[model samples]
Target: MSNTRPSLTLTLLQAREAAMAFFRPLLNQHGLTEQQWRIVRILRQQGELESHQLARQACILKPSMTGVLGRLERDGLVRRWKSPQDQRRVYVNLTEKGQQCFVSMSDGMESNYQKIQAQFGEEKLQQLLGLLNELKQVKP
Candidate 1:
């Protein structure tokens, strides 16, 4: 039998889990799921975005995005409205509460990032990020 080792996909996922371990506690303290945090972060950085755009950026499926948005809206963290130009299109933005939440969590997030950088080395982290970005461009 041929020797079997961990596949690249499995290795990547393990690495992701390892990295998230450092930040998951902070996210939990803020009562945010990974997906919720991703949405909030993107909205904070990109301002208002269409529902589809938010989903695409967050790498969430359309159906799952609806539920996530519902929770955020219920929590008063986000507000959604239909576009005036195209009622079929929906836009989402952070509420004042959401902005506050992001600001409050920013420090903790930065601290966790620093811990990761210190443990993993900043140069290697940047190189890994660059490689991951390049990997995204790979076609099947």
Candidate 2:
């Protein structure tokens, strides 16, 4: 039998879990799921985005983004409107409340990041991020 190699997929997931452990509690305190936080962060960073674009950037499926966006809208954290140029396309943006939420959560998030940075040395963390970005450029 051919020797089996360590699973890169599993290793990536484990690393994700380890990284998320740092932010999960803060997200819980803010009553946000990881997906919800991802959407808001993407919208905040990119300004307005089409629904599909938001889903892509947030790494959420298009179908699931609809539901998550619904909750965010209901909670007054996001606002959605039909695109001016395309009636069928929808755009989403953060509301003032969402901006405030991000601001409130920023310090705690930064603290957690700092703790992680301390644990994995700043240089190593930067190197990992750089490598990950490079990996993302690889074509299937």
Candidate 3:
């Protein structure tokens, strides 16, 4: 049989799964799904953002984000309001509870990150992040 080339998409997915394995338990323990965690993380870093902006930054679709935001709101982890300047736009921000959750989990997350970094080597991990960020800017 002829040799086949390695697939970039598959390799990237494998890397993501490997990374997620380290943090999934932490997320599960906190009663958060991956998508919910992403939303919280983004909101913690970015403060208030329009729903569309949150969806874009979190890499979640608007439709999925609607349901995720609803659940987050119901859990008291997030709050949303219609924009005063534009009634059609909805903005989302984390509540104090969400901030506390992030703060509480950040140490463990950082520890897991350090463990992953140690396993991957700091320089290689930095290079991988740089490459991935560069890939984000590339237009199809």
The list of candidate 1 runs beyond 4 A from truth reads none
What TM-score fits each model? 0.95, 0.97, 0.95
Model 2 over residues 85-139: C-alpha lDDT tens digits?
8899999999999999998999999999999999999999999999999998999
For candidate 3, the lDDT comes to 0.96
Against the reference, the lDDT scores of all candidates come to 0.97, 0.95, 0.96
Candidate 1 local lDDT, 1-140, one digit each (tens): 99998699999999999999989999999999999999999999999999999999999999999999999999999999998999999999999999999999999999999999999999999999999999999999
Ranking by lDDT: 1, 3, 2
Error of 3 at 88 (Å): 1.6
lDDT-superior candidate, 2 or 3: 3
Worst lDDT window (10 residues) for model 3?
Answer: 83-92
TM-score: model 2 vs. ground truth: 0.97
What residue runs in model 3 are displaced by over 4 Å at the alpha carbon?
1-4
**Model 2 worst lDDT window (10 residues):** 39-48
Which candidate has the top score in lDDT? 1
Per-residue lDDT for 5-79 in model 3, tens only?
A: 999899999999999999999999999999999999999999999999999999999999999999999999999
